[model samples]
Target: MKTRIVRVLVTDDHPIVLDGVTLALQNTPWLQVAGYARSGREAITAVERLKPDVVLLDLRLPDMLGPEVVQALRAQDSAVKIILFTAYPDHAALDAALAAGAHGAVVKDTERDDLVDAIRRVMAGERVLCINAAGSSGAALSRKLREHGLTRREYDILRRVAMGETNPEIAVALGLTRNTVKTYLQRTLEKLGARNRVEALSRASQLGIL
Candidate 1:
């Protein structure tokens, strides 16, 4: 039986980058290029019309930043999957994207196959982050915090909170109740020896967890 193709919308201000992404997706059997856009407004329009399963979004759109674009898309349709594509993969940026409801992130310099793999993984319902490219700092932070004995879920919640997401947003993303999110946040704070969310975020950054 033939596999279903994952429809994708590619958005970037640069024509060359857009072409490169289209070419890469063309080589992947399970991915179908549905549309391309050169600006945030165009991307939003295409998303509204095409409703592709995945959107490969560049962080530096001509009209808007990637995080804002993702937030706008999410506000329009909560189920729309957005994969942040960028050259700069700083922890702060990654956290912003996550908070804005992006499903995955891939660096612009990522290998073609790895990019394809990320798309497939996100399609398969796994949150994808290019750890080597986009998350080295965050990964190191996570490692240091692991020594403190925080549960995986609590750690995840803490990271999300550090990214500026509210408990309700984190709960929705993680499929936890509002009270459960609060409880996890409290436990995470205790584990990090933090007095508050801001303190925890700062400590996590120092320890390399954000």
Candidate 2:
């Protein structure tokens, strides 16, 4: 049997941008454009009505910030996957979206294939970052690392942790013993004042470290 198509709800303040996105996804057999919204309120309402599998969210909605929309969506249904679509591509915007529970970020100028890949990756349960947009400045991320007081090794370990690696897996990847990996994670948690790995990752992403 064929797999079910991924239903998508798109929101953008600009009519032309919305039209362009709709047109680009029109021919993808695995995706369906379920609805479109021009504002955050409309986006919320449409998302509730459509129960789409994924949301293509514009960062600058006329009525609300993109992060607010993401939070609202998560508050309504945590399972709804959100992909932030933005023209700015700034680190702060990318960090905010991820911190607000966005599954992916795609620049407005991204190639059609890249955007589609982001949607696909998010649907597959992977966090997608548009490196071109996300990597412009290490300043914000570095500052976050400093704030977290994470050593270079701990930073590497946390990145692997956020990617869902097991301690043994991380140890193997980093060429360290499992016990050593666990110790690093413990130190990382204490430095960041995080209660757990999840909280640490969340804090790191917010600080743009992840």
Q: In terms of lDDT, which candidate is strongest?
A: 2
Q: Which portions of model 1 miss their true places by more than 4 Å? A: 131-210
- Write one digit per residue (lDDT tens) for candidate 2, span 1-210: 997899999999898998998888988888889999999889889988889999999876656555667888887778999998887665444565576689988888888788888999999999987756476534555565676677778877876676557999999998999999999999989887899988887776556565
Pull out the clashing pairs in model 1.
Answer: 141-208, 141-209, 142-209
- In terms of TM-score, the best-performing candidate is 2
* Candidate 1 residue lDDT tens string, 83-117: 98887675444665676799988889899999999
Any idea what lDDT model 1 has?
0.78
- Flag regions of model 2 displaced more than 4 Å: 137-210
**Number of residue pairs clashing in candidate 1, backbone atoms closer than 3 angstroms, sequence gap of 3 or more or interchain:** 3
Please give the RMSD of candidate 2 to the true structure: 8.8
Clashes (backbone N, CA, C under 3 Å), per candidate, total 3, 0
| Model 1 / residue 2 / CA error / Å | 2.9
